[model samples]
Target: MFRISPFIFILIFLTACTLPFNQPILTEGATVPRPQNAATAPVEEQTEPPTAIPDTQTQPTDIQNDTTNGATTDNLEELANTTPADRDQVALVEALTGNDLPEFARTEPLDVQVGDTETFWVSDILNDSNYEVDARLRYAGPHVLMYFETAVDDQIRQEDIDRAAQEFEERIYPRNRALFGEELSPGVDGDTRLTILNITLQGAGGYFSSADSVVQEVNRFSNEREMFVVGLNSFPVGESSYGSVLAHEFQHMIHWHEQRRGPAWFNEGLSTLAEDLNDFGDDNTTILHIQNPDIQLTTWSNNAAQTGQHYGTSQLFMRYVYEQYAQDGGLAQLIQDDAGNNLAAFATMAQQTRPDINSFADIVADWAVANLVNNPSIDDGRYAYSLLPETTTPVDLELNTINDINQFGADYLTLPTGTTTLTFDGSDTVSLTGATPNSGQYAWWSNRGDDSVSTLTRSFDLRDLTQATLQFSLWHEIEYNWDYGYVAVSTDSGETWTTLEGQTTTKEDPQGNNAGTYGLTGISGKPGIETDQGEVGQWIEEQMDLTPFVGQEIQVRFWLIQDDAYNANGMLIDDVRIPELDYVDDFEEADESWEGQGFVRTTGTLPQQWTLRLVKEVGSETIVESVETNEAGQANISVNDGETGVLVVVASTPYTTQTATYTIQSETR
Candidate 1:
């Protein structure tokens, strides 16, 4: 007689559209399985096919007579008796269901009330030590791209998947350190194990507090087990960008170990703060990258129905608090005070320590007014030509590793407390360089846009750039510590310039100190291609399309805004380049409708060659964006639901384009 294990059944059942969402529920007293030490190692290749044939010699004699459900009276007896053997088997099953248990020292079973909360204990069907370790590392290894054979519905792409994983790691890493201090190490105990599985899009992740249902979902499977599985043809980012997501998830594992529950703000905010890009030395000075609260902050504040208020606002608010308390080592104090507090108490503490905490809405308004304004220091007279709009000091450009040192100088950048410098050996290829602890600074370009005319000596061009990349190294002092300056660029040769994304930053907020250095720095320069653009956030290596500007005279300018009146601390910029494009555009224009009262279609054949951009003017941050057009020449966009905004339309062809505008209502919902 042949018998199939539950694990294989689970993998096959959940592969299609619907995943099992219902299962036996429990509260506490469930036994989760302990993991082995060897699980964290790299997975060795499996040369043999994964199949098991039952040991016929060990089979029970009555198996043929009671083959139904593959259970005999003896088997039923063991389950009913709760004997040691039976209990052990049960424990294994529970363990398999929940993936792995947290470390023993930090967690102990407690009597949970049925009405208040539910618990899961699935230890009955444990993956044998060898099996779990062997499969886990193989699936989770950094080099291997773990994905599904056939794509899942709305499945995330490899780039997005890698980014998601990296972002998760970034948020998790620092929280673990701050929460556990120095005691936390990933993959040390069975507690930190992760299960990446190939569940359908709807059932991929676990619920807020549904461990029991998760157990049942895990149990209803057979064939091929992955602690974590990619469903149908998934790939990871290239080796060059591997660690971000892994670090993120690992941090979650660490946080999950703690038995205490805190508010979502504290849990996620700290996680956002704790996310590190892994580029710092012992001395704590950054080498290449700095933390970006903007991503976390911005995403959190988008209040549309689909907008998430937790991460973005929390990250920004936490950053604000960190800036206020960082100097006095008040970060730990603030976190501790807010840890167990209820929402009101937490809000009170936040108000007292940082800003008022009416809600994320208030925070977004304040942030936009204070930081998003177009406060460029340079005026019209400052550029190489009189035609360009004025900009602030601090010129922006794309800088590469080699060219940065020469242009920005070595003094501007700092090595973390214990980080080493990158080096290029005789072979002429760059390697991660090592060095003693150090911090440095640079005094690069300032935007002449805000200054009196400076004659152009030469204009930056990208005609020779093919198969090359553009990157920039930049930094912002802790919030309000704005002693430093920044850089900007003009693709139109300084006639008119746009603020480089992430051109400026407020100091670190009071609650946290500076986020340590990171890799994956950004460029202050805009891409040569009009379609390929850059925005505010961490540094990036974006490709440029030099095709449009080839042989066309291009102007470039840099700025150095040194006004410390508003912020005493300084900013830094280094490196520049023009890189080749890696991806082609799949330009799909969506059908769009505006629900606002004042925004209706105008008559005039909709001017064929006009630029229609969605401009969201939030305080100082006015984002002027052009919408993609369809074959019918229709474009679509929407503003923040409650905020009134104007959509700017310009017709530049046939003659010098004239501008028109339409206002958006606060909310239609």
Candidate 2:
């Protein structure tokens, strides 16, 4: 929970909103202070890595998932830092970074030696900024300069300072750079010596200010000099936690030079892991995440529960990634990924390190399962926690407690103890993560409910077609190698099932927690055409071949399956229609009612014109069309196996007012 953000408090409290520090372990190092008041949401999101606003995004917050601008840009920094419950200084810096005003015109900070007195601007977090710290450079290491506030007479013990200084210079400094690379060498300060100012901060253990990373031009509170801030009173001087806190903050300094605008979850995750690599540790916080595994993986909020969960989730994930992927130095490649991203960067790293996976959700899925059983012997260790010991509390789930999981969040659901395979009674998982729809005014989104399935089903008569293909537009990010969104055909009147393969389908062992048992719908330990990995951030056209079943009466059903843990933004099904696949059904809850009367026929002449689907406000001039549906209230769309055609739709004057009125009007020309 060390990574707190100012905006998270604003979003969590509807208006607005750290920990105490610890001593150092000169041997292995101590853990960081329990970062209190971190901004996080039980609502779950990494965009909520996964920012698709719904159609009616009129409000600033859409309850659990969507976090929009509740206030104006002018009030952003103010609101973000105004929450009484959260005086997180780190968040204040995040707010300033978003304004994009300050330019990094290095002020050429004075290079001082050990025993030189200097003053730097420090944020008075409790009082909304403003403070001056007169600190004397106490230790000059080969790689860093440590300073202590001089105002407190005899406050810091000399030996404690010496121990802390020695650790930073001799231990923490070298290990951090060797593992995670350097912290802006000769950075904005134009020197390899990163200024570490130990001042009395308000409520933060410590922070690396992006504002200070740049020279203060438009902003005055900036030290104008490059320095990282750590609280003096928060931690005992000689404490080993210094290694962790300093290492954590140092990573932030390194990241600042990359993407100034980045996801707090990812940034904090890497830094939290930095603590571990520095010999300091996470204080066994993974249990917190294991207990409440449903928090959104990529979002930050200001609160006690979410803050703790975010840190625990992120650190555990990073630990998993580093341990599993670092063996071949792929972890460094992951570090070099686009810093401004969330799951996408992890996805890119996965493609390179583990060829079997292709989505960040894939790693998350494995991590989720591994959290339950931290055994390296299981499934070739693809789903166990090697970062932390296997000694953890057992998972206890209250029935029917799992529901409506958000983007990049995860939930663990258990079937009856003796259950071998998972079959939804009628429930589901799928969610929308982007704003622009694939093709209509709206698309169907399935919330990624754990151990659930979102389905779209209807009877299809493919007896007459020589060649048939079920085509649709979809955007999906499912936990790869573990979860899937697939299409299954039932020819026996809703009795048997066969997974249909499409352009986006792939096969993998989805048995993380469900190992040695059946998990996905059709395939047990084998491969099937499923929405496994890969993050299609936007909607893309895809097709399911139905030509093989051309001479049969089968019920075609679109499905999305989630295992016992890990979630991402659900699938967005836009234009395919078993009578409009947009009418998605949470298969675990109810059967979908896709009401429409249509037949697929192959006639080269009549079917030459492509079908146009129009979603327009009644009597309004704006008509969102799949084809050219502009003039008359008619759409001529007929498709065969030949050349593609366009559908033209024309609206009438019956739709004149725009007061939240919508109509799906399509006619044959």
User: Best-fitting candidate, measured by TM-score?
Assistant: 2
My TM-score estimates for the predictions, one after another, are: 0.26, 0.50
Question: Please, what are the lDDT tens digits per residue for candidate 1 over residues 1-669?
Answer: 000112222342334123221111111001111121011122222323212311111111110111112111112122112111111112332221223533222232222221222111211121211111111111232322233323242344556555545543454344445543322222221233233432221111111111211222222211111122221211133422233223323333333334122333344444344433232101111101112211222111111111122333344444444443332254444444433222233345446645634433233223322222223331211111111112112222112232211100111111111222211111111100001001121112111111011111125455554322223343222112111222223455344432222212222211111111010111122111110021212222222223444444444322322110011111222333343423221111211321111111111111222233343444555454444444333444544433333333222111001122222112222
Instruction: Give the Å error, residue 619, model 2.
Output: 66
Candidate 2: regions farther than 4 A off? 1-113, 339-344, 351-354, 387-402, 417-422, 425-669
lDDT of each: 0.25, 0.46
- Model 2, global lDDT: 0.46
- lDDT score of model 1? 0.25
Candidate 1 deviant stretches above 4 angstroms: 1-242, 276-310, 326-368, 371-669
* Worst window of 10 by summed lDDT in candidate 2: 599-608
